[model samples]
Target: MGRLALEVADIFRAHGPAWRQSQQGQLSLDQLKVMSAIEQCRSAALGGHVLCCEACAHTEIAYNSCRNRHCPKCQASAAQRWLEARQDDLVPVEYYHVVFTLPAPISAIAYYNKAVIYGLLFDVAAETLRTIAADPQHLGAQIGMTLVLHTWGSALTHHPHVHGIVPGGGLSPDGERWVACKPGFFLPVRVLSRLFRRRFLEEFDKLHCAGQLQFFGDYAALANTTAFADWLAPLRECDWVVYAKRPFAGPAAVLAYLSRYTHRVAISNRRLVAMDARGVTFRWKDYRAKGRTRYKTMTLSADEFMRRFLLHVLPSGFHRIRHYGLLANAGRRANLAKVRAVLHVAPAIDSTARDLEATVGALPPTFVCPKCGAAMIIIETFTGCRAIRAPPKPRGAP
Candidate 1:
């Protein structure tokens, strides 16, 4: 296969050292580690193996992946594995896509308080959905949702938000029937937006009062409780963004959507256009524009590019993807079973054994001969940055 013309790793390998030096004392350990991983990913520094095709004698060298979640190259396999695990969890109902975004002010503070504010975003969003869905005036059912947090916009700027995949309906409070949402609509976005604003601010205030928030730079004054409250006042009245897209066509479409969003990084290598003395150029969406005009390319200096990329390195151990309500891990299986029963549909086949076998057996071999369609077997392995020596000659060498 041909090599990619550009990759985030290429940029990191080319300029990370100088950039890291220039930003000394400012970069976090996590950000530094991400830079290191991306630089070493798929390079000899990480080690690799040699594969030889049995039928054609075609040889190839494959390097190991860094497997860092922040590395763009490493997320594809992770996403696939995650999607496979989620297949059984998919109910037959239509799935709605909802997004809850932080307003600009909160998003600014979230950089320093990522763990706290992001956790609050997930919790408050989930609570808002459950609260509204449980209210008799609304859907009045217990819903399950999977939420994925995206911390960057197309331009690699900090724009924290959660994308939620929710079934079109929920289980009735009595648990005897499925509470299907009105055809084509989930809940009112206006109601969700109003409640999300209130609950998020309420929880945010509690965090401030409890001294869980940290303020830095221009926000240092926010350490004062009164000042923080004053800053948050306008946000209380202004609307928080909460919107629902039209329902996905079916479970298949939902899976396709999740594959694209669930493991996405701040930017993918495919989006990278060029790197040169001018800087790195890449594609970004100008959401305010219409039709084809929305697609745009932007260039940023290498330092700025690396800075923007590292801006999204999440705090250690923070869960960016979360499941709530019926989808909560502890009770997901039972809940899905119940929902299936209520829908009068056959329960999702318990394919644990089959899935395991298929997962192991179904995937095509990683190494294939370029000249012929044949599996390639590893002939040798090497570790670290060591070179791969030629394979040993047969015992009866000429």
Candidate 2:
């Protein structure tokens, strides 16, 4: 891909040091690491290779990628690899998109207790789906779903939510037959909304009782048990945002959708328009608006931009994408086999040969010549902080 006009890395490299020093003790280790990674990503600070084209003898330097999960530039390849692995998991069934969002009140405290609350969000949402689907009154089947966590809204606000991609149907209790939902509909949104709210709050309460929660700033008073309970009372009565979109057209469409969301960062470099004396300007969609009016641009000071970007740095080793119920990692293969059997559809094609080929160095080259479209073979490798020699001239060049 051609270089972008601006990037998060640019902002970090230009302003991160000053901003980071200003925050001092306020930033977490994980956040600091993220800033450093994005700043040094694809730069001479990380080691890289020199590539030369066989066709034209053209050459260029190819810097190494940080491969950090939080880095926007690195997730595209990661998402593609993840999608290739999941290609076999898709069955010939309608897939539904569902979103579960925490209310603003809980969202405020979630920053201080990210791991705890985010964990509850994933678990409670999955349990709510399984419980309701298994009820005879509903689908009466054990459904599977893939849930991906997103912690930022369009304006880079702290909004914690999970987007669930679920097959429109499930397997019956006996595993003898396929149980499909009514055409185009997955589950009752209101029902899912209520159950999700109650269950999440129940688990949230338990965490507080066990002293697993932390509060700071204005919420510091919530350390008292009575105050905490009182704080959570209103959330029970309020309607939590849980909604499901219509079914996807086909399994290919499902894969297309997953590609966009599965490994997404808070913001893509494409969204950034400019950075100057005014600040960082970026495009954002205002969902509350209608038609063309919804697309807009906003600017934030360098310090605020970095602060909002870092707001989404997840806890170390936390899995942002999760599979649950029928799609649970442990039994997903067997479950898919059973589902395909009941549907009388052929099973997914085995990719052992293709995988073996990739493992044995049959994969395509990582970089290619821009002028001739030929593979670019590495001629030299350099370590971090080391200078690379000048590129060789193309064939016939003086």
Best by lDDT: 2
Q: Give one digit per residue, the lDDT tens place, for model 1 in 165-245.
A: 999889999889999889999999999999999999998999999999999999999999889989999998998899999
Residue 3 deviation, candidate 1, in Å? 2.1
Cα deviation at 332, candidate 1, in Å, is 0.3
lDDT of each: 0.93, 0.94
C-alpha lDDT of residue 84 in model 1: 85
Q: Which residue pairs of candidate 2 clash?
A: none
- In terms of lDDT, model 1 sits at 0.93
- Name the runs in model 1 displaced over 4 angstroms: 355-362, 386-398
Residues 269-371 of candidate 2: C-alpha lDDT, one tens digit per residue:
9999999999999999999999999999999998999999999999999998999988999999899999999999998877664578556697676777899
